[model samples]
Target: MEQLLDEFRSTMDIPWSIWSARLVGTVVLCGLIGFEREVDKRQAGIRTHILVGLASALYCIVMQHLVVSDEFATDRVRTDPIRVVEAVTQGVAFLAAGLVVFHQGNVRGLKTGATMWLSAAIGLACGLGLWGLAVTTTIIAIVIIVLFRKIEQKAGTHVPGHKNAGEKEA
Candidate 1:
């Protein structure tokens, strides 16, 4: 068991400590957001959110290492950070799309999909060492999910696409 762990650690060019910190942060942030979704009976909840965030963070870490390598610095190999961001965004977009459902002319799960996307973004931020950004975004997400729900309920405002009376039947 010790040898297996050592081999795995050696395979990672990054220090295991760094990986541990980023992954844990990703899990925590995503888990908190996902807990809210779970409470609301979302199909994709804590486990899904944690996995998505972990994957994004791992991708970012690998890309970061490649971009900073000496080969790129010496050979003038152009590295565009936006490309990495775009790739992650596209991957997350696919997952988000899967979360949405259109049934009988009504669209549902937009909030769940959006929150999943946010989880990926927070993971990316953590991977890039933007700890402050990830924390702030998580707090804001929780606030929106919890507080806004109360406000919506008290005001009796039907969400725009959620079976609103003015919406036409498909």
Candidate 2:
């Protein structure tokens, strides 16, 4: 058991504490955003947001590690951070697409899809150790969801299964 534990520990280059912080922070921030969705009964609620945020954070961490490894290599290897971020964005876009549905001339789940995208961003921020950015983003997201919901209700702008206030289902 000692040897097994040693071998497992040897596989990780970064400290466990750093990884734990990133993962836990991502989960907590994303979970808060997810809670708003849960209250509103959105399809992609807590679990989905948490999973997306966690996975995105893991991806960011791996990408950062890969860049650092390349930086210290004997043979120089180019590492483009933009490409890594673009890949992450594409992945999150795919996940968000899964939540969207078009039916009977109406689109559904737009807000939920946007929420998932925001969750990914929050995860990336946490992974990069930008605690302030992550926290601020989460708070802004909650405000947008809650405040906009109220505004929509008062303005009658956010109609279910409809494009706009004046658009009727066909």
Candidate 3:
């Protein structure tokens, strides 16, 4: 009974405006990155990215509340928020790794994997209420995903362990 009540209170710990802002901001930022992936027809598209972002943010938000609760408030608990981040990182990395593949001496889905990783990062930043960092990171990611890809294609740029843009697969 007390545990149930604690969960309810944790949900309400943060004000509506702040909570909504963090979630919505995460959606918009992650959405942009996901949109690019979708346009590229990547396996991990908008929905995957958005969900990843929200999950990451929720982890931090919930941790913030629990950290202040009596269960964790005791000095003996010695709570450090970095653990939450590490947990999120490992979780996201597992998901992102699935999108990556190695076949025939060429790696694929590298960009999608990196994007998924970044989505979690953006989510964490938004959840921590670092809107500026989240927004800036999102913009930079978009530029790299969109503009840089175009440049690489047009220039036939070479990437390690992969053929140049114009090279035919063996």
Per-residue CA lDDT of model 1 for 59-129, tens digit only, reads: 88888887777657765588887787899899999989987888767677788899989999999998888
Q: Best candidate, lDDT-wise?
A: 3
TM-score of each: 0.81, 0.82, 0.84
Q: How many pairs collide in each candidate, listed in order?
A: 0, 0, 0
Runs of candidate 3 exceeding 4 Å displacement: 1-11, 156-170
Q: How would you encode candidate 3's per-residue C-alpha lDDT over 26-111 as one tens digit per residue?
A: 99999999988887777888999999999999998988877776767776778789999999899989988887888666678888
Model 2 — which ten-residue stretch has the worst lDDT? 158-167
Candidate achieving higher TM-score, 1 or 2: 2
What TM-score number comes out for model 3?
Answer: 0.84
Per-residue lDDT value at 67 in model 1? 78
Q: Write the per-residue lDDT of candidate 2 for residues 39-87, one digit (tens) a residue.
A: 7777788999999999888887887787767345546677676776677
Please report, in order, the local distance difference test score of every candidate based on alpha carbons.
0.84, 0.83, 0.85
Identify the candidate with maximal TM-score: 3
- Clashing residue pairs, backbone N/CA/C < 3 A, model 1: none
